[model samples]
Target: MSQPSPQPDRAAGHNPRSSGPGRLIIALYAVFVVGSLSRAGFQIATRFQEAPLAYTLSALAGVIYVVAAISLALPGPRAWWVSLAAISTELVGVLAVGLWSTLDPAAFPDATVWSGFGRGYLYIPLVLPVVGLWWLWSTRPGTVQD
Candidate 1:
């Protein structure tokens, strides 16, 4: 029996982009992707008519989470841009939905991932974008990444 030896990183002086906080951020995004997808899938399957807006928004959020997670996991400039775009959109969605939910509670009728800034998810949705952005900026600059 034998184990594979460690391979050298492509970057000469750069650390792995998915190291440290990036790992945490990626893990969180993965959890949200699963959670939002499950919730939206169930709602859409059994009770979409009850709250189409909320359910659809949940599904959209899940897609965004999946994109962000994948972008962060990959190593390239395209992935970087995709990650930024996804996270930025997520921030906007959370803020808009949170404000709307506050101003017009009846409008929601049911909770989405971004409702009340993700209150049901312990407000991680509200903070994730900022953390993700920071991780992106802190990582080394290049086409190959993560």
Candidate 2:
């Protein structure tokens, strides 16, 4: 009697995308989302009048981080696109805010998430997006060899 053929192994099992270092990246992004969203919400609700621009930027950063975390957790072309968009936005925000604050410190009398290149957040804001892009590129479909 012929034996039944074994089932094909799923790519998910060894998907280097969300395994190993990728998992740590996702966790870090998630933590940032929580912290940023909470801080932004509190600042906007209670002290938006104090610094509208700073509060708005904080809100935007929180949203970008949320998107980044979600996209990193999922595996697909759409997720990859979302990750790229979010990370790109993050990089832009950090650079723009960093430059604007440096040139005219008075513009940001109050600190935003991207202020001083995330000096308030240990500069993770500056480095996280670059690392995120690297993760996405390394884990592109069929790019990770067994």
Candidate 3:
């Protein structure tokens, strides 16, 4: 008798990122994308001459959030790495922007999404990346599962 062809892997449907708590991470990122972009758009359009740096930074933060959310929701190794990079970038951005804004308040007459360590957003921008990085590390493929 001819040997039967092996069945397709059943685990193909499993997506570690978006299967559980990752959903919450993606959701939060989505909210940030909307909030930051909206603020940036309004500021840039209404008064670009007033706080161009702050408005531009807000727009950049919004774009980062969009990348983070999409990568977190997608499946596979590439997406995981993209998510990692995005989250790491976000953390650094928040820290640098926060410190800069704090030490040199004159540099940022208006707040960006990450100004004062996301103080304007209740620090969600500060905390979200930490949580996202933790989640990515914990859910990485090849980990021993129960």
Best by TM-score: 3
Which prediction has the highest lDDT against the true structure? 3
Question: What's each prediction's TM-score?
Answer: 0.86, 0.88, 0.90
Per residue, candidate 3 scores C-alpha lDDT tens digits across 1-146 of 99988753426755678867889999999999999999899999999899999999999999999999999988777888999999999999999999999999999989999999999889999999999999999878667252
Off by over 4 Å in 3: 1-13, 144-146
lDDT tens per residue, model 2, 1-146: 99988643434443455788889999989999998889989999998999999989998999999999888877666777888899999999999998898888898979988999999999999999889889888887656654
Return whichever of 1 and 3 wins on TM-score.
3
User: How much lDDT does candidate 3 score?
Assistant: 0.90
Clashes of 3: 0
> By summed lDDT, which 10 consecutive residues of candidate 1 come out lowest?
8-17
Q: Per-residue lDDT tens digits of candidate 1, residues 1-146?
A: 89987665644433455777788899999999999999899999999998899999999999999999988888756677888899899999999998998889888899999999889889999999988988887764553333
Q: Give every collision pair in model 2.
A: none
Superposed Cα RMSD, model 2: 3.3
All candidates' lDDT scores? 0.86, 0.86, 0.90
**C-alpha root-mean-square deviation, candidate 1:** 5.7
Task: Show where candidate 1 strays beyond 4 Å.
Answer: 1-15, 140-146
How many backbone clashes can be found in candidate 2? 0
